[model samples]
Target chain A: MKPYELTISQAHERLKQKELSAVELTRSVLDRIHAVENRVNAYITIDEKLALDQAEIADGLIARDNMTPLTGIPLAIKDLICTKGLRTTCASRILENFVPPYDATVIEKLKSAGTVIVGKVNMDEFAMGSSTENSGIKITHNPWDLTRSPGGSSGGSAAAVSADMCLGALGSDTGGSIRQPASHCGIVGLKPTYGRVSRYGLVAFASSLDQIGPLTRDVRDCAVMMNVISGHDAKDSTSVPKSVPNYLDFLNGDLKNTVVGIPREYQSARGLDSDVADAVTNAIQTIESMGARCVEVSLPHTEYAVAAYYVIAPSEASSNLARYDGVKYGFRDRDKSDLLDMYRSSRSKGFGPEVQRRILLGTFSLSSGYYDAYYRKASQVRTRIMEDFKQAFEKCDVLLSPVAPTPAFPIGENADDPLTIYLSDIFTISANLAGIPGLSVPCGFSSGGLPIGLQIMGPHFSEGQLLKTAWHFEQAIGIQDRKPEIGS
Target chain B: MKITPEEVIHVANLARLDLDEAVVEKVSHQMGAILEYIDKLNEVDTSHVQPTTHAIFLTNAFRDDLVHEHLERNQALCNAPQRDETCFLVPRIIG
Candidate 1:
């Protein structure tokens, strides 16, 4: 296999054996990026000189035998994560030229691990939409099928990894942003427990629901990344102070005592494509044959998840995104003569339609006479959703379900109907609402050849167990080697 | 309609977003549909439940008052759309 095609573990092995240098690997990936980027459009920015320089530094570290697993690895970052000196757009024109003054805590951690920073990738503008078509920058096509979306708002991150544009990527999940894209792109994506990873530098989409995690070609690579990026940070107070376990230790590939919960509600969920349901059924059988037990568990509040999420996410987003007013560090409307007019014009012109829609929805929900009915009601429903998970977890070690209701649809399939896109996230949004970790592993392919992902979720800080369960399933399936055909 | 164009305009003003007439019409329809869907929350009897603003229980984080290195004035002002040597310049707020 070419160097760009190697997973993080494989690249690490070759680098350790002196069979490859970090510089060569970085160069190979850069070349692959240049060759296929026109078709994939996975990246918003590419700083080759900076990436090569970091790889050179990695080579020195490797030569001294002082290196972590990620040392010398090339990784893509979701544009929302702050990388000092690199323009972090968040796929919104408002911050199109805004460069963060400092690295996010995760970026700092990755840099210390000696990973080469490839560049920022696109996302739905401010992470407001289910597809990257909301990106104010560029649309990232699915590597599996160019006409289909690489499900988003982490579309570019998934597309980058799936197309071999980068070894691994960091994508933040507010509501299935990471896992859904990984599902569509046929890779492994993890949304760690809400406080498992610090959000100090992630451009806030919805403060209480957002978490940063890894998207990689395999479960092991995801674990490798988790080891480096997970843990408490003084910078982000919401980050848990709990100690992080070495996630790699959990990937024993043994499923002998595991109990998997198959959500009864999920089986009968509306809009669940038959192809996806069949794939997940086969996945359950594969796990069951490996000496694991599967039980039917009911999360009765499942139907209300999208409703609660749409309200809560947009509410928090309205508050969190209020800082952009053309005054401090984003787009400005110079022609406006007054301050309020300037704020209005700058935001109106800077934000995309989806973003505007969300801001309006959030503002409406929080406005006087509406707060109790919308925001408060959603919060109450959120409490119910969390309780449902708590009760379900009492019966099973992990919950298994399809990541998305279906494989990736065509690019513009649900663009005009925001409500339709919101409904599609029903399967994955509950995890974010309940503050649990979720893993999406490639389960099978649709008859149309699009990928389907099986989501494995566990209680808060249960990433180790989730990773182990996913690893076992991956090993049994032996489909991680499949690659999208991005012709030369 | 669940929400009217006038309501959209009112909320847009509250959010400090300047939506033109066409966008106001479009957003009014879209927001109306979304709100109608969100109305599904009313189906649950949450009368006795405590609202959950955050998923995880967290206490307020306290830190020492000791001075620490922070963004330099230049770094802080670096990305400003309009800035002087030290301050971000904005449209006049005072008469």
Candidate 2:
């Protein structure tokens, strides 16, 4: 296998054994990125020189025998994470030229762990859309079929890893940004429980829901990334002070005595494609075969997830994004003379249509006389949704469902209808609403050969259980060897 | 319509967006549809339920009142669209 195709654990083993150099691995991945980036459009920025420098440092660490599991691995970062000296555009023109003077907490941790930063990948502008089509920079195509979208708003991150542009990547999940794309691209992604990973420098998008996680080639690599990125930081108050477990310890490929809850709501969800449903059902049977006890459970408030998410996410976004006026940083409309005119003009021109729609929706919801009817009402429903998950978890260790209603869809399929796209997140949004950990592992493929992902969710801070369950499912699935025929 | 063009424009103004007539009309229609769907929230009675602003509840985070090294003035001003030596230059807020 090419160095770029090596998973994090494989690359780390090779590096530790002196069979491969960090520079060689980083160069191979960079060459793959240069070779396939045109067709994939997975990255917003490709920092060759900076990546090589970091890899050299990683090589030095490996030579000293002071390497972490990710020490010599080349990884891609979703563009929204603040990387000092690297242009961190949240895939929006507003921050197109903005460069942070300091690294995000995760970047600092990754750098300390001796990981090489390949570059920043694209996403939905402010992570507002389910497809990367909303990206102000460019759309990321699915590696499986270039005509279909690599799901978003972490589409670029998923496509990059799936196409072997990077061994693994860090993706931030707000609603379903990380897991959905990983599902569509046939990779493993984990969205840790809210506050499991510090969001210190993640550009705020619905602050309460946004979380950073990993998209990797398999379950073990996801655990490797979680070890490095998951922790509390003083910079973010929401970060939980709870101790983190070594995720690699959970990957024993054993499902004995595991109680898996199959939500009745997801089994009968509207618009769930037959291929996705069959894949999930088959995955459950595989889990059962491995000594897991599968039981039917109800998340009664599942139907309201999408509606509550739209109201709550946008309402928080409108408030969080209010800082993007023409003053401190990012794009500014300098042509306007009046201060108020500049604020309006800068924001109107700086933000894309989807972002503006969300802002407008948020503003409308939070507006006087509408607060009680919209924002407050959504919050109450959110409470019920959390309660539903809490009750379901009482009977089961982890819940199983299809990551998305279907596999990757053709680009521009739901572009014009925002509501249609919003409905697509029905399965994954509840995890974020309840602040629980969720993982997406490749289960099966659609008739067209697109990937389907099985989602496993657990209560807050139960990432260890979620990772273990996914690892067992992945080991038994026998499809981990499949690769998209991109840049080969 | 769940939302009118007038309300769309009003919300846009409140959000500090300078939307044109076309955008206002389009957003009005779109928001109307989205709001109609969101009205589904009313189907569930939450009369006695408390609103959850955050998924995981935690108390306010506090630290010792000691200053640590932070971004320099230049570092903070580096990404500004317009800046002088120290402060971000903006359109005059007052005469």
Candidate 3:
């Protein structure tokens, strides 16, 4: 197999055995990126020279027998994460010329581990849309089919990983951004439990709901990535103060005692695609045959997840994004006559239509006399959603559901319909609402050849179990073996 | 809970966005549809339930209020669209 096609584990084995150099592997991936980037448009930035330099340093480390699993690996970063000296655009024009002076906690960790920072991938503008169509820069196509969307706000990350442009990618999930795209692209994407990974450098979308995780070629790479990225940080007050577990060890555990919960509501959720339902039901049976019992669990508040998420996410987004008013950094409308006019003109011109819509919705929700009717009510419903998860977890070790109602649709399918787009996250948003880990693994392909994702969710801080279960299911089904026909 | 076009315009102004007046009706319709759906949450009796602002409990970390080395002024100003040698330049607020 070509070096670009190697998994993190495979590449590590070859590098340690002197069969493949980090530079060689890096070149192959870069070459693959060059070949497919026109069709995929996976990256917002690709510093080939910088990546080669990092690979050289990794080579020195490997030659000295000072190596970590990711020491010489090349990985893509979602543009939302701050990378010192790199333009972190968050796929928005407001920060088109902006570059960070410091690295995000995740970037610092990746750099310390000697991973080649391949490039920055695109995302939704301020993470407001379910599809990367809301991206202020460009739309990323699904590698499976150029006509279809790869999913969003981390659409570029998912597309990059699926197309082998990058072995792995870091994507932040606010309301199913990572997992939904991963499902659409037929790869493994995990949104670690809230506070499991530090949010210090992640451009905040919904501060309370956002969590950074990995989108990788397979489950093993997912676990390896979780080991490096998951940990508490003193920089972020919301970061949990807990010891990081060796996630790689969880892969060896058997699934004999695992109890998977199938929410009754999910099976009958409105707008669920027939093919996706079949794939998820089959996945449940596959897991059952592998000794993990599937239980019929009820999360009565499941139907309200989309509604609660739209309100709560926009409310947080309005507050978190208020800082980008052309003052300290980012785009500025210089022609405005006064400070207030400047703020209005810069934001109105810099932000895309979808972002403006969200800010309006958020401002409306939090406006006078409307707080109790909107934001507060949403939060109260969110509490009930968390309670639902707590109750469901008591009956099963993990909850199994479809990541999205369907696989990837056409690029402009839901572009004009914001309400329809919001409902696409119904299945995956609950995990974020409850601050629990949610993973999407490729389950099957639609008749149209698009990939379907099966979501596996666990209670807070239960990533270890989620990974092990996903690994077992991956081993049995061999779904990751089905590669997208685009990038390669 | 219908969202009027006037309310939409007011909300847009509050958000510092100058949406085209032509698009206000469409934006208002979309926003109203979303709000009416979220109104479903009102059907659930949440009066007794406490609001969850953050999924996980977090506490403020107190630090010794000593000044620490901060971002270099030049680097901090590097991305500013309008900046002088030291600080960002903005339109005059007090004229």
Candidate 4:
């Protein structure tokens, strides 16, 4: 097998035994990236020289008896996270040529741990769509079926990991950006409980809902990457101060007493793909057979989650995205007169159509005349949605649901119908709204052979439980070892 | 709850985005459809509910206010399309 096929743990062992040198592994992965990246549209830029330099440094560290969890691993970063001197576009034209001068908190952590960053992966232009078709640059296709999308705004990251372009990837989940794509691409994506990971330096989408997380091939690697990236950063005031746990250790604990909740409301009779529904149901049965209990719980306000998220996300986006006004940062039109004209011309030429639509929706919601009727009302509904999750959690330790309504859909399938695009995130948005941790893992395959994923959500900082439940289900179903045909 | 073309134009102005009339007309219809679908929230009795702004309860992630100087000004403006010696250059702001 090629070095890129090894799990992070296996890679680490190989590195220690001198069976694989960082340079060799990095080169192998780089070669794989060169082979498949164009077809997948996974990378906006590939810093071959920089990645090789980092791998050399990691080799030196290992030679000196210094090793970290991420040492010598090749990782991809979603374009949204700013890396000093690297062009961070967020797949939008507004920042088309913008290069950040400082590393985001996540980048700083990755560098410290000796992780070799291969490149910036593509995302939805400002994270506005479920399919990467919204990328202003280009669309990322699913490795499972090239005709379908790899999902977005972290589509490129998912596609990269699924295609083994990198050992893992860092993606920011504003609303199902990470988990949904992970589901579509058949990989593990975890949105750590809000504040478990820092948001500093992540280009703000919705300040309160966005989080940086890992996309990898397995759950243990997710936990390991989570340990490396999770923690308080003085730069980000929103990051929490809780002590980080050894997530890998927690996975070995007994799960005989685990309780999984099946939210009755999520089992929609309409609009849900029958294959996905069956996959989730079968997953629950598998978990139940392992001496765990599955209880039917209700998130009564499940319907309001999408509505609330759309309002609150856009409102925050309107405020947060205001930074790019053709003045201090990003694109500036060369032929404009007056400040207003400059602002108008730069933004008009810079932003994509979907981004413009979102900005408008957000501005209107926060406008003086409409604030009470829209933004405020949405906030109130957001509270009810949180309450529904809280109430359901009281009945079970973790909530199980499908990560997306279906598996990967054909590219441009929902491009014209924006409402249908928004509904694609229905199952995963509530976790972001509640500020809790949610993970997506491959469960079974659709009849068409595309992968289906089941999500396990836990209360804030209950990542250990979430991982344990997912691990238990993974063991029971015995699907963790299966590889996709894309690479094989 | 329906959004109209005039409202889209107004919001576009506030956002500083120059949308063509046809784009505005298309988006206005789409936005109206979405709003009408979400209007089902009005039927739910939420009068007694409290609003949730942040999911986590912690507040005030305060940091020292000391100045932490960053990238040189030139580096910050390196990506700008047009720039002068000291600042990013834009179209003349005055008539």
Candidate 5:
């Protein structure tokens, strides 16, 4: 296998033995990126010199027998996370030239562990869209088929990992951003429980729903990355003061007493592709044959998730994104005569149409007359959705469903249709809504040969259990060993 | 509620976005359709349920009062589109 194709665990083993230096591994990944980046368009920035410099330092740590699992691993960061000198654009032109003065907490953690920072990946502008076509910077194409979207707003993260541009990438999940893309790109994407990972510098979309997690080629790599990024931080009040488990240790490979619940609402939802349904149904059967019990459960409020999410996410977005006015650090209209005009013109020109649409939707939802009708109603419905998950967990260990209603769709298929795109996140958004851990693992491919993903969701902080179950199922299916023909 | 072109422009102004009249018309139709679909929530009664702003229960998270190192003045201003040596430069606000 190519060095760039190595999982974090595999790379760690080779580096520890001195069989592969961090520089060689980083170079192989960068070479792979340099080879297909034009076609894949995964990264917004690739700082080769800085990446190699970090790899050299990682090599120094490895030689002294002092290292973390991620020590020599080259990982791509979603542009949302702040890196001291790197341009963290969040794939929006408003912040296109903006660079942070300090590292986000996760970046600080990764740097301290001696990992190589490859570059920033593309995302939907401000993480407001399901497809990366909403990216103000670049459109990240799926590795499986260049004509298709990789999924977003974590599209670049997923695309980079699938193409072996990087070993693993960090992605933020707000309404299936991470998992959906991972599904599309044929890799593993894990969205930890809300508050499980600190949202300190994760540029807020819906402050209540967003959580940062990893996208990797396999489940164990997900676990390895999870161990490094999950922890409590003082900077984020929402960071749960809870115990951080050694997630890798959960990969014991036994699903002996596990109960996987299949949500009926999801199984019978509108627009669910028959191929995706069959693949997920097969995944449940595979786990059952492996000694786990499969039971049908219902999350009655599932139909209302997208409706609630659209209102809640954007309303919060309107407030959180309020910081991007002309005055601060991002784009500013120098020609405007006054402050308000400057604010209006700068934002109008800096943001794309989808972003503008969302901001308007948000502003309307949160306006005084409509707040009770839209925003407050959405929040109340959100509570009921959380309650439904809580009730279902009483019957099962984890919920098994399709990550998306369908496999990766053609680019621009729903670009102009906001409602269709919003409905695409039906299955995965509930996990984000309820603040539960969710994972998207490659199950089977569509008749069109596009990869379909099985979404495994668990109760709050059940990441360890979720990863373990996905690991067992992955081992049985052995799909992670398969690679896209584009790079392979 | 039926969203109007005038409403779209109003919301855009509230959002600090100066949009074209055509874009506002497009958005008005789009947002109107979205709001009509989201009207699905009105079918469910949530009068008794408390609104949840966050998934997990958390309250004020305080930090130590001790002084800690922060970014230098120059580093803080590095990404500013228009900044003087001392601060960010914006259009006249107090005139």
Candidate 6:
């Protein structure tokens, strides 16, 4: 099998028998990336020499029997992450030349685990859109259907994994950035409990909502990657100090005692594609067959989530993204007079249209006069939505729903309509708002042959349980073995 | 609920951003539509709910103040578009 196509477990087994060296594995994946990356546009930067050099070091550690689970793995990182020497653009022209002086905590952990990073993947500028078409540099196409998007702000990472350019990739989820793309690209994407993973090196989108996660081909790989990337980091003040779990240990048992809730609010809604509805229904039936009981539940405040999210996210983004002034870091225009001109001209030349729109909305909402009406009211609504989730979880172990209202739409379908674009993130944004964990796994395909994803959401710090449920579901459905024709 | 092009341009200035007139008119109309949609929030009663600042229950996540390291000034300035003897160069103000 091609190195890029090997599951994390299979690759580990081959490494143990000395059947493959980290250098060889890394090279093979890089070779595949070279073959197809232009067509997929998965990477913003491919560090061929740097990856091989790191792989050689991993090979030496393995020779001494000092191997970590990720010792020889080659992974792609979303451009939103700060890599010390590489330009982390966040797919915006403003930060096009910005390079961090330090590695993010997650990057530090990945290096410690001996994982070799192949390159940085593309994304929507500042994680503001559903389709990667919002990316200032280029659009990352879906591997399954080239005319469709791979999903955004983690679109390039998802495309990289689906197109077999990398074994796995790291992504950041503000709303549905990870899950939406994973659904679109037909892969497993895990959004660990918000504080479960450190946010130190991630470029700020909405500080309260941004979280780094993994995008892989299967649940097991997502679990392994999570173990390595999660835990407390002093650099990220929001990180939790709780002991991390060996996620692989929890992938046991059918749901005999597990009570999975089917939120009637989700199924009763309009706008859901018929194909996605069917896939989610069939997935629940499969879980029922495995002894897990399904019960109807209500999240009465579901309607308020998206509304609260738009207000809160933009408000936070307005504050968090304030650091990008010309005087501090990132792109600055040369032709400008005085401080005001410098700030305006630099920002005008630097930010893309979508980013500018959000910044304006956020600033207006948070402004002195409007704060009471917009931002304040939204905060109150957020509390209600969180309470709704808390109440539902009391009756169930986890909640199951469709990841998105539909499968990936055609690439340029909603680009012109900003409101239509925001609606794409409706289903997944609530989790971020509630600071819970959610994972999207490919259950089946739409009638048009696009991938359909089933969403599994859990309470705070319930990532282990969520992954286990998703793992068992993946096993029962046996969908991981289904690869795209573009798959290696 | 309806925002005018003038309001969009005003907000853009307050945010220290520059938007072309065409973009301002376009975004103002779109934002007007969205805010009009969200006006439905006025009907829901949220008087009893305490505003949620964060979803997780944990609090007081602080780090020690001791400085561990510092970046070399030259390396920090490497990505600067224009630089001078001691700091970044910008258009002269007092002229």
For A199-282, candidate 1 gives per-residue lDDT tens digits of 999999999999999999999999999999999998999999999999999989588889999999999999999999999999
- Please report, as a residue range, the 10-residue window in candidate 5 chain A with the lowest summed lDDT: A479-488
Q: What residue runs in model 3 are displaced by over 4 Å at the alpha carbon?
A: none
Model 2: how far residue A44 lies from native, Å: 0.6
Give the Cα-based TM-score of candidate 3 against the true structure.
Answer: 0.99
Q: Say which prediction, candidate 1 or candidate 4, comes out ahead on lDDT.
A: 1
RMSD of each: 0.8, 0.9, 1.1, 1.5, 1.1, 1.4
CAPRI class of candidate 4: medium
lDDT of 6 by residue, A179-200 (tens): 9999988999989887889998
What is the alpha-carbon lDDT of model 3 when measured against the actual structure?
0.90
Question: How many angstroms is residue A105 displaced in model 3 relative to the true structure, after the best TM-score fit?
Answer: 0.3
Error of 5 at A143 (Å): 0.6
How would you encode candidate 3's per-residue C-alpha lDDT over A1-488 as one tens digit per residue?
89988888898999999899999999999999989999988899988999999999999999999999998899999999999988899899998988999999999999999999899998889777777888999989999999988898899999998898888999999989999999999999999999999998999989999999999989999999999998989889899989989998899867899999999999999999999999998999999999998889999998888888888989888988899899988888989979998999999989998888888888888999999988999999999999999999999999999999988989888767888888888898999999999999999988888899999999999999999999999999985456877635
DockQ (C-alpha based) per candidate is: 0.91, 0.91, 0.85, 0.70, 0.84, 0.69
Residue-wise C-alpha lDDT for candidate 5, range A1-488, written one tens digit per residue:
88998888999999999999999999999899889999999999999999999999999999999999999899999999889888899899999888888888999999999999999999999888888999999888998999999999899999999998999999999999999999998899999999988887778888988999999989999999999899999989889999999998999969999999989898789999999989988988999999999899999999999999999998888888889986768888889979888888899889888888888888999998999999999999999999999999999999999999888989989867898899888988888888999999999999999998989999999999999999999999996445888944
Better of 2 and 3 by DockQ: 2
Total backbone collisions, model 3? 0
Q: Is candidate 2 or candidate 4 better by lDDT?
A: 2
- lDDT of candidate 3 at residue A131, scale 0 to 100: 74
Which 10 consecutive residues of model 2 chain A have the lowest summed lDDT?
A: A479-488
Evaluated on CA atoms against the true complex, candidate 5 attains a DockQ of 0.84
Residue B76 miss distance in model 5 (angstroms):
1.5
True contacts kept of each: 0.96, 0.93, 0.89, 0.72, 0.86, 0.66
- CAPRI quality of model 2: high
Query: What TM-score is obtained for chain B in each of the predicted models?
Result: 0.93, 0.94, 0.91, 0.84, 0.92, 0.79
Stretches of candidate 5 exceeding 4 Å from the true structure = none
Candidate 6, residue A301: CA error in Å?
1.3
lDDT of 2 by residue, A343-420 (tens): 999998999999999999999889999999999999999999999999999999999999999899999999889999
The parts of candidate 2 lying over 4 Å away from their true place are none
